[model samples]
Target: MLQALTILSLLFLTDFTMAASEDPAELGAGLQNPGYEELPAWFKTSFLDLTEDVAEAAAEDKRVLLYFYQDGCPYCAKLLRDNFTDREIVELTRQGFDVIAINLWGDREVTGLDGKTTTEKKLATLLGVQFTPTLLFLDEAGKVVLRLNGYLPPHRFAAALRYVAERHERTGERFSEFYVRTNPREAEGDLHQEAGFLAPPLRLGDNRRKSPRPLVVMLEQPVCRECDELHQDVLRREAVALSLAAFDAAIVDVFSREPLQTPDGRETTGRDWAAELGIEYTPSLVFYDTQGREVFRTEGYLKAFHVQGALDYVATGAYRWQPSFQRYLSARREALAERGIQIDIMR
Candidate 1:
């Protein structure tokens, strides 16, 4: 089954080397001795000139893919090792786009599409790059047509590539819509039900005015393997369940046209609201504060630990002071370690 394969792949991802060492001589030869992130050799060696890079790729009748990464990021390693090694994905990438890597915290100078000059880190900030492996797919005009905020496994990542490569956005169809229409997977037959979720005839705006708890809108599809795992494995954990207790949770089928009141009091269908929120990944958990403002969200495939962390991050009102989820995760892990508990992200 796909769910079994997904879990199996995640287990292998835990073996990535994170030890500190000098950068490898040949990047992307698999995880070399060095601990630093290794990009695929096929990634374009560029001068970080966005304007020129776009033009050059356009000349070759290809689009541009800007890969933003950080050193020692496990997901980035998974992307390079797992996704890039797929012959189909590699060939599709080579045929359609010029892939360029940009270090999220590097000091290398970069020229922006707006003709402004900035360092890699500064440009990342300017572009609101909050997660590693954030991919920006640009059109010939240097406009980002699609932006992926975190790592996606090969299947979804390939769909993303094809979406941009075929210029689906030019037809006025969002990537999320296109993906749903093209790729339909087998599921457990129905949406997973949770006791914590709000009852139907869902009026989120009205509920927010009555309850003081934060709200979490889970956007999922019936035909999703990850969604099945989320409900079957991740949510069943005690810590994860406890964290879920702090919020008023709601689950919506992203492809459904069923009407519901949004947290901001807008009447819209689940399908429309999902497209508005850019819900590209199934089983995306979007968290909002008590006042109806978005605080944080997790859109990638994550295990129980990270899921619990995201819940605690919002439930504890930590986002008020800590804007960086990665930093908060680090501090959370260290705090747990002091109590003689070792947390594994893939677990």
Candidate 2:
């Protein structure tokens, strides 16, 4: 009877150990296994070059939460498996912040404000981060809003997010105001103020030859939230604006009665032209080659880097030699990656 009891106990213990090992969420008190369903709607998984972009986002009322992690960092993995994967935290992050994950030991290069370049590991050291899983919160102007060292529990992390969000809601007060009040700077000009607009108007088609460069028609509606966001945020930047100046650009309001001539020689009002283009969204970029042939079209908002890549692809005719647009995009990414410039693929 004793031998039988011992055998049964051993079997039960083995089974329990196997179950726990298989379940990542059960491995620890706070840790939870991640799944696609658990990912926050607003948590952008798209990889982006966060170095310069963070500053620009601050100007647009977007705060950046930058997570520095390495491959074998258990704490970093725990945060991903537990805190970030939590449904509530994911939802909250989606609503409030633009999150970026950086490999701290990565070999990627980052450009500094003074035009100097350094590796990701070197940059981490310069930022005074001594450990993995450091979270740096920056306003749209690239000012450090908060810095959290070591692992943060889900509850405390949520609280930190709330604190930042509440502080950000006070519009009249700039990030510089709060930062300078606490840590005074000798510099007079606001760093946040220098964060320029993303998109600007084209030079009204100066590059037009007997064969024009290309025509990029933007379909916009007055009160469209996405349209307004793109116009004010992505398109207003100097780089984007200058690139756009090389093309014949026009913004047509969908409700307008202004006449437009289609590539097919058919004349119609701007409203009808929008309908013919099958543009259901307020902000859509329709690209036409020199001969007025539709090369490509992208609907919705795009960030600066992706937008730049897309423009470069179409302008240089890179698509003609590539297998597909997707492949071309991959090649572009690899090229940029080689130069240590990361671009958000989602955009």
Candidate 3:
């Protein structure tokens, strides 16, 4: 009897240990931490001081490029492997900018351009870095001349490099103008119309005040493959479709002259408004509150999970309380985990 009782106790202890050993991240959204990538040797090694770095780069007749990334990020890995590996791109980047990498969830001390000290993670939060591999191209004054929210394909990435490196910003030409002029590509057909999107003559000024729903203006171009992919694939997902039900979406061709009233009650054409907003990337989704205030925006290639998260982030009014979209996503993963729902972000 004593021997049998000891064996039962051992079995219970083993089961408890096994349960405790399970990864907590798996219980939530399947946010896999892709292992770290070895940064290029030519990448600038710094003490993470933004002011000094900007000054030093300016002294060399170069700009500052802030690369925000996280461990195990596939897109980040792609940017390094695809864009950085190109000889022309590497040479242009090395000659024109001082690149500094900041981990999205790192603990290293960072002295910001504002001369305030913070952790790398906090600095990311302050900059509102919602996605991995968000790159900020800064002018000599440390102003973000251009900000790429997500990964851009090689052609567009190279165009962006030239736009800044060639001092197009000083010429008063928008990056969008430079990109379209320099790197025109044959894209798929017209805007993919959805039943959920509000038909044109979009008086967003009226819609915001009258309806309780938020506004999502999709700034796209006729010649954009990414826009085509977004409409054909990402929008067709069930989760993304469900989230669209919560907002009044408007699809506007960034180059079109369609007359529309802006959210701030200004009468303008779609093209003018898009230029005014600095909508550089095609298929940029700009979200606005019922009060006509801009809430959140996403301007690069994104999968279904992230698209849905962006929709839900503004739709649920979560942006009011949670300033950091990354933190909000973390909380969302935790909440979904509690309900036994696992999400694959890359899916």
> TM-scores for all candidates?
0.50, 0.39, 0.49
Per-residue CA lDDT of model 1 for 1-347, tens digit only, reads 99999998877555442222223443456645433644667889999999999999999989999998876788887677556754457778999999988877677889999999998889999999999889999999999999999988777788899999999998999988988988834346467888858977689999888899999999887646677889999999998888999999999987677999998889999878987997766789999887778889998778898999999999998988999998999999999999999988898
Off by over 4 Å in 2: 1-211, 344-347
Write model 2 residue lDDT over 1-347, tens digit each, in one string.
99999999999867654442233434487664332112223454533556555655565566788777764467776576446644346656766678866556555666643456786677788888877789988765566777888887655666667657666535666544545444421211111111232123222223233435777777665534455456667777787777776666667665456665664456677667876786655567777787667888777456676676667777878767763766777887898899999866655
Worst 10 residues of 1 by lDDT: 17-26
Report lDDT per candidate: 0.83, 0.62, 0.83
Q: Which lDDT value does model 2 have at 243?
A: 75
Give the total clashing residue pairs for model 2.
Answer: 11
Q: Which has the higher lDDT value, candidate number 2 or candidate number 3?
A: 3
Minimum summed lDDT over a 10-residue window in model 3 is located at: 18-27
lDDT of 3: 0.83
Query: What is the lDDT, from 0 to 100, of the residue 325 in candidate 3?
Result: 85
